[model samples]
Target: MVQPAQSPEPDRSPGPARSSEPARPSDVPADHVVVLFGATGDLARRKLLPGLFHLARAGLMPRRYRIVGSAPAAEALTDQEFRTHAQQAVAEFGRSRPEGPAWEAFAAGLSFGAADTGAAEPLMAAVREAETALGGTPRRLFHLAVPPVAFTSVIDLLGATGLAADGKVIVEKPFGTDLASARALNAAIHAVFDEARVFRIDHFLGKEAVDNVLALRFANGLFEPLWNRDHISHVQIDVPEHIDIQGRARFFEGTGTFRDMVVTHLFQLLGFIAMEPPVALEAGPLRDEQVKVFHSMRALDPAHVVRGQYGGYRDEQGVDPASDTETFVALRVAIDNWRWSGVPFQLRTGKALAEGRHMVTLGLREPVLRMFPLETRAAAEGRSNELVIDFDDPGSITARFLVKEPGPSMRLADGDMLFNYRTAFSAQNFLEGYEHLLLEAMRGNQSLFTRSDGVERLWEVAAPLLDAPPAVRPYAPGSWGPDGIDGLVAPYRWHLPDRRDATP
Candidate 1:
């Protein structure tokens, strides 16, 4: 069934001054304190700090709240200093830094606290101080911006320290290096916080385009009619990046393309794209459906999945002369459910590739009994229709379908039409992944966040390729990908738009 296009309900026109993005429900509550566990790190500086600044600048954050940064030496970093730091990052990061005192007030709420990993004393004390200082009776939220190694200890400590009482920790991806590890990590997190308090993030879920994907299907009458196996042949998702892993040599060295990209971002999105309609758009119902997709995905044996590591793109500083790490991966998966039994989902993602971009492509099954002559069918290449969602491109949603050429010919030709969201609606000045997700968690809106079981299922499905590595294809810098990636789709024959742009 196709999702019908939905009309804005309950005064969708956003109210007030919080976000420039979309107008959220006015009733949306904003009452909570957000603590940053690692406030000095790169992730904190680039994403977390600036994101919090965005929330404050936009008024998405509450007026009565505390912003605490905890890590080693939390006492040394004062509220003013941390706020100033956040201000600078926002100036460097915010798309259009909102003018005036909004920035000032946002920064003022920012505070710094030194948190200890081994013992929760300093951390708990710091938290207590922030609570007391910020006015005392607010909900506590801990954003774990630390690396994976410190996860177990920090979560355990938070529980042992009673920091998780009204706490919520935003866990980053690659939660575990793999499936078994993911399970262990989940267990540790659950030991402290309940499943609801643990928000596993897949940034793509926060992207307007990503969420619209579901809406495009569920809320549209036109697409729902053709959403099933009968109308769709395959789906292709590509997250390509041209940047090599230089600084991330450590992370990438351990996590190849499959673990880094496909497991979290690609599969997470797939679960959303392919899941059945939930009982409601409520968080639990939606996530439950996605979990089913993760469970239904065909288990890819080493043979079914391909892992590729191109030459010359080793550690940025040349850490390893020979890195077996694969910078690229492509796999064909089938969903055995009744709705999409025979459909194929082609999933691929990579960094250090020939491109720096991402997109989701849906190729509808070809129309039957070619009414046109064989010559015409052969020329059109048998593509019934296709829809491509380009995230990094000039940012537009487009449909590739058969339209009669104007005037003469009267022949069916493929013409593309685009629905530019930015052009259609004044693009809402919304927060990026980090800020948006942080606020959602704060508001108890788990709609865009990942569930624990979803994370474990992701690892469970992708774990097979760890040992069953596929052929390592090769591609050059500024190149689309390895020589034969296109041929991999020979069975279904997906259309390559001219030369694949070195970017997604």
Candidate 2:
């Protein structure tokens, strides 16, 4: 039986105001060094280096900070060569290219090392040399941009070489393939670093609007009263991509849509949306609330879930002709708790769909406002009061409400109110999601990172679905997911993007 939603403890209170700007590390460690493990890898080129450059440009780089890139079999790059490489990467991937002086200062802090991270001696020796050059027992941050298989190995190496002292580790997600593996990985990490010293990255949690969910819910009284199962009919969290997997066949094969998106990104979003008000916004309190929600999630019923694969998936390179791997998934999850008991949380993500959107839409139950008359059923149906939070480029919050039409005789029309981040803040405030998260990790702020308990609970909710996956239906590319998903969220069709243009 579902339990009633728990209320906030009497003593619970909002924590310190969340930093409006990116957090700057206090007491810059003279020995601050950021080691990029997969320095020459694709993620480094596309996200890490560009994000670091943006941080430096924002004057958020610590006083003694330096970046040491490492990779086995990678050619050793001199400072200048690395700087040039970074410049190119930033040019290609950054939101905006940096100015000459800003780029130069950031580049001056760059260096490179080549070592097999699996081997303790060579990697440690390279890191030590970088530290010596900086001349301090600098706070070290090791970022693993490599594959998950290498996680334990690199962590073991870090401990064996004594680099784990006064050091922190940043691990990228899809934390583990499943619940059991996630437990093993967490145990391994705990052995090497204190829980407080480990930062797990889930870029979705760091987005500007997503980070504001707590503040929006707790900091204001306007929405809290209506934030329960009583007022919201259903919640839709949909992330659709219009492009095919761009050469990620190998990774995609090991992790389909469920593991890649549903388990990590979708669950983290659920944590924020359903958590009881935290006593404070500090890491511990915030994460505790998240864990509670995860624990409260009811086991997903196979009948309420749907899966699909875009046509031609098997034609993709590295894909098996007999592959039944799902490239798309849609789930209707019920939280077995008071506040969300009957409310179905709809989560769906797919590659090569019609629209490329990352947004959450909350369908509010129509209130008994006698002031507005529903002359027709269609009019009443169209009067859905929705709150949409779009998490993609140019993030925004949109409120759709009903208003009287200009014509006489009390006709009603749908209207929208939008708050776009780009318009509200300066262009500089539009940092890539990774930039904000990487900065927080550097500052040792775990508020935006996932906690171990929350992670395990996430897998617990997802493991059943993975262990016995639903049948995969085929859907054409450039179409909203499998047609059958429409029935899963019956009475409330997907809030799809406009069909004015087919291209992403």
TM-score of each: 0.89, 0.90
263-329 per-residue lDDT for model 1 (tens digits): 7788888888888888899899999999999888877777656666766766366447577788888
Candidate 1 vs. true structure, TM-score:
0.89
Which candidate gets the maximum TM-score versus the true structure? 2
TM-score of model 2 (CA atoms): 0.90
Taking the tens digit of each residue's C-alpha lDDT, what string does model 2 give over 1-504?
A: 111111111111222111135433461223368889888788999999988776665556665567878776545665567778878888898754744555655666677776665554555665666667667466789999988998998888778778788799999988998889999999999999989999999988888888877777898788888899889999999999888888899999889988899888988898899999889888989898888889999877777889999999999999988888899999998888889999989999999998688888889998776676665433545437788888775477777777787876897677777777767765554556788788788778898899888888888887678788888999999998887998888888777434321112
Model 1 scores a C-alpha lDDT of: 0.70
Off by over 4 Å in 1: 1-28, 74-76, 96-99, 118-122, 133-136, 373-383, 392-395, 493-504
Give me the displacement of residue 447 in model 2, in angstroms: 0.4
